[model samples]
Target: MDELIARVSAAIGVDAGVARTAIGHVLAFLRKELPDGPVAEFMNQMAGAHQAADEASAGGESAGGLLGGLLSGGLMGLATKLNALGLDMGQIQKLGHEVFGYAEGVLGKEKVREIANSVPGLSQFL
Candidate 1:
């Protein structure tokens, strides 16, 4: 996860903390939108992954409301979340690539690819 943060930070020209927050927001969004099973399992196994997700969503909005917004707006909601974390769409795409590549290293390329493909709006970034 640290390596991923570093790589994404370098790729997007953001500080490590900003990179981490952005990555957390992206991962949290994915976790919510993806189905149960291996993807969820893998996310859980990764240290700090779930916490990152939780922290990203920790805000004034209720979790259900936030999730509802995400579901209603889809990529737009994702964009909003990423934007709140100080990342633009291009940076979000780059973050997706870096994070997916990091997932590939940790969870195997095929598994990560499968997970990426399963998410509705995620493939564009991949």
Candidate 2:
């Protein structure tokens, strides 16, 4: 997790704290939105990723899945969620690029691509 934070911080020009928060939010979003599959397996391989996602879940950082109908509530809810974290749409897209690139490095392109395609409105960011 520390290493992921460091890489994201450097890649996105954000501080470790912001990177951590953003990463937590992104991962938590993915965990909630993605079906059980390679993405989940890939997330499982990352140390502390689930913990971060769980923390977001427990803290209601993701609106406690209030957008449940959006599957849950699509990317608008996610954009709103990320916006609350001080990231504009461009920054969020950059974060997506960085995080997805990083995930590809770890989990390979095919699996990461699968993850992106599986989530509604996620491929646009990717």
- Model 1, runs deviating above 4 Å: 60-73
After the best TM-score superposition of candidate 1, give how far the Cα of residue 75 lies from its true spot, in angstroms.
Answer: 2.0
TM-score of each: 0.82, 0.82
The 10-residue segment of model 1 with minimum total lDDT is 59-68
Clashes of each: 0, 1
Residue-by-residue lDDT tens digits, candidate 1, 1-126? 677788999999999888877777777777777747656876876788788777876741443365546553566776776766667778888988988887777788788878877877677776
Cα RMSDs, all models: 3.2, 3.1
Candidate 1, residue 84: how far the Cα is off, in Å:
2.0
**Candidate 2: TM-score?**
0.82
With a 3 Å backbone cut-off (N, CA, C), the pairs that clash in candidate 1 are none
RMSD over all Cα atoms, model 1: 3.2
Each model's lDDT? 0.74, 0.75
**lDDT (0-100) at residue 108 of candidate 2?**
86
Clashes of 2: 1
